[model samples]
Target chain A: MTAAVEIAGITKRFGEVVAVDNIDLQIDDGEFFAMLGPSGCGKTTTLRMIAGLEFPTEGSLKIFGNEVGTLPPNKRPVNTVFQNYALFPHMSVRDNVSFGLRMQGTTKSEANRRAGELIELVQLTGLESRKPGQLSGGQQQRVALARALVNKPKVLLLDEPLGALDLKLRQEMQNELKSLQRELGVSFVFVTHDQEEALTMSDRIAVMDKGKLLQVGTAEELYERPLNRFVADFIGQTNLLDATVADDDMIVLGNGTKIKAPNPHSPGTKVAMSLRPEAIEIGRRGDVPADHVATSLNGVVSAMNYLGHSLVYQVKIDWIDLEVRTDPVASEDRLGPGDDVSIWWDRTADWVVPDE
Target chain B: MSGVITPRGASRTLLSINSLLVFLFFYAPIILLIIFSFSDNRNVGVWGGFTLDWYGEFADSQPTRKALWNSIQIAVASTIVSVVLGTLGALALERFTFRGKQVFDALLYLPIIIPDVTMAVMMLLFFAELAGVLGLSKGFATITLSHIAFSISFVSVVVRARIAGMDERLEEAAMDLYASRWQAFRYVTLPLIMPGILGGGLLALTLSLDDVVITQFVAGPGWTTLPVFVFGLIRKGVTPLINAVSVVMLLASMALVALSLFVQRVRTTDSA
Candidate 1:
């Protein structure tokens, strides 16, 4: 299928400040793509440019092969659900959902009928006449989704649509939004600051920071093989161990531990190795099987936290804290702070990320 | 509740006393005037038997009636002009940034900050100079224009406050839903700020109706507003007739104020 949205060499400058640096991306049709970044990372700006709410100072933006950079928002073939669910406060739920159709010159009866179907799809069937103010936050969010989807635009842009909801409601809405996009089979560009949300819902995720696109790939690809230090630290918790390249496939850590990585630079080239906490195995000395252990380090447990299903232990070794997460098991002796333990992990789990 | 009640009782009692004093200071003179308006005596401050004679006399006064008509005409014209101009001015100031914006903002508040006497003098001199150059004379038109000039600032202040309180995302949402800029403003921004526009209009109407000094400086032959006429009557003497007229004007002003407050309340409730 042809690309649903194509951005080429887009750079949005406000006076002397660059809000979005040179960015070129292609979003496939029917793909659930996410732009993940912290605040002021230009994720929302890029989304706005795609929706035609903003025009790039330097580039071409196309939707389904049609150049739409200079088009106004009203002329774009896309709809946005704003961060605050910006539903028209003066209009009823039905009117708000029907607004796009009415603006497109659809007759009132047809618009209302279409809106009614979307309302039911969002599970807000009886709230057709209620004003936005009378509804709860979650209901309002669903109303916003229905309103944007009711237009049946080629692309749907959502800017942190679940940021306002509580944790439980956010999870529920996240699933609903994912299923809705699946059912519609339309391109969805979801902008969020949440790594978990992006990982859970996106077919592909783009990590951005400070007006620059850092990395873009599938969730597993980006998480397991973050190309730079920012992405490796941003996606999840990881303890970075500074190391110098020892050979073509090995590096020496500051603590003198030798590890193997996929791509090795020249000898003495500084690198950072990223190790996930869950990948590390922790046990008393002589407990771990020799066949499963590739490398081992001894350290004292500095801190231990019980998380019901799992126990997180921070092991202090040679002035570096290595985190180990494991499922809780029945034992008379539990690992507590100040307990000596051995931590080991598979050599394949050591991933090399760019320094700085 | 009991734990929280120890130190607040004295403050609450003091607040009530302060409110009582404020009410007395504000309403005592107006209450006295209303009471005397119904007295049969010719002079005020001496109560005679209750009678509606002064009100009857006020109704029969032809000069007072003509002055009332002139005030209404000026108020209506000036209110409409000021509301339209002020709403546009507020939209420009609050929604857009342009060159000399700070200077324009400072100038917008000039009419509001200048004293009434100074403003009246300045307007009179400016109008007189223009009238001389154009071979014109000051009259109803000059008075209406001056009223509008001063009233525009008041209207813009109110409307700008309303705009500031409004959510800009509503208009953006409208535009995203395929509304043109004009359509978005007409359907969303205009309705949201209508209460402020009405409040400003009522304020302008009341200001024009109550203007005495500006009208005095600008009025030509046979062009006296109610306030100017009432000032003249006060200079001649204080009478029950004056009291009756003042009471009626006060009631009308009060009604307009009440309506303005009611509009603001409705707008707040709608938004909430």
Candidate 2:
């Protein structure tokens, strides 16, 4: 089947500054896709190009095999939930939701009937006559969602839709949005700076930085094996150690400890190794089994942070410091600062990434 | 002593007295004018008894009626032309950036910045040149044109302020919902900025009605607005008829201003 959105060599330039550089992507039908990046990373710009709100300076954008690169936003078979909701303040909730239908020449009664169903879908039945100004922020967000979804476009473009909500409300909306996308079975192109939100909601995420698509993969693929240093640092908390390839299945850490891991690069080539804090097991020396240890090092605990479920210990070994997360309930001994501990991980725990 | 604050009650009393004095100073002449307008006496400020004779005379006077009609015509005509042009100008300045935008912006403010006498003189010369070349004599057209010229600035200034506070994303939202560019403007932007347009139109009407200096300079023979006619009447002599006319003009302008304020209040509440 053809992709819902096929962006080929898309690049958007505002005068001299390239907001979205040449990047190619394919979002599958009914797929929950997210473009994840920091602010000014061109994620929003890429989404706008898909929605036809901003035309790419150089690109061939196709929606279901139809060329829509220079098409106006109104002509595109897509809808956008803007960052700020952008509901018409003068319009009632019903009118706002029914606007797209009305614009398409649907009769008022027909539009309202369809809008009523959507309002109920978003759980805003009684607020049909109330203006956007009268609704709370979360309610306004729902109205924005309903407004965009009422059109039933092939792809729904959401630009940081939950960025305005409070943390608890945001989490609630995040679950709602994920389920809503599932229920509708429409492609969703969500743009967000929050990595956790992207990881939790998106089926496949395109991580972007400096107007470039750095990597595109599943949550597990990205977190487990990031291609470069930037992807490893961005996805989640991980210790990226500067190392050099020593053998086919080994790498040397800065402290000269040989770690047993897959090294894609040639020998003597400098590389970076990503080790998740949870992957590293910390205990007293000689407590861990010798067979389970791929590499082990003795370190002194410099600091500890209690995170309710787990304790993150900053372990200092020679000149290198590694963060080791341990489940407080599983471990009998409570480690503190200045305690001598051994940190070890399985061979599969560490992945080698290019230093760039 | 320097750090000590004034007592609340004492400061309140002082502020009340100052407010009373200021109000009295401003309204005393207007109140006297209104009261004397109802007087039966022929001489100014002398009350023989309460009577509606001056108002009757004002209604009966053909020249005064003609002047009033002329003022209304000029005000309405100028208001319509100015509001349209000014709204377009404001949208251009606020929504787009083009070559020489800064110069155009500065020029839009010139009419509002210059003194009335200076503007009047400049308009007089402009109309004189137009009359010489285009055979367009200064009359109703000149007065209306000059009013539109000055009123455009005021209307645009008010409209630009409204546009500035508005969110541009609303227009984008409209377009994203399948509205064409013109449709988005009509259904979304126009309705949103309507209060400003109404306010600006009222302001232009009020300014056109109240104008005397510019009207006098541009008006040809037998083409006098009420204010200009009133100014001419004042030169001949102040009469009870003048007071009645002044009261009527004052009340009409006040009503327009009140309506403008009402429109603004509705906008604030609607947006809030």
RMSD of each predicted structure:
3.2, 3.0
Which sections of candidate 2 miss by over 4 Å? A255-258, A267-269, A285-294, A305-308, A329-335, B1-8, B262-272
DockQ of each: 0.52, 0.65
Q: How does candidate 2 score on lDDT?
A: 0.92
TM-score of 2: 0.95
lDDT of 1 by residue, B54-116 (tens): 888889999999998899999999999999999999999999999999999999989999999
lDDT: worst 10-residue window of model 1 chain A: A286-295
Name the best candidate (by lDDT): 2
- Residue A21 Cα positional deviation in candidate 1, in Å, after optimal superposition: 1.4
Model 2 over residues B104-159: C-alpha lDDT tens digits? 99999899999999999999999887787877787889999999999999999999
Give DockQ: model 2.
0.65
TM-score of chain A of 1: 0.93
lDDT of 1 by residue, A131-206 (tens): 8999999999999999999999899999999999999999998999899999999999999999999999999999
Residue runs of model 1 more than 4 Å from their true location after superposition: A255-258, A264-269, A282-311, A327-344, B1-25, B46-53, B134-136, B261-272
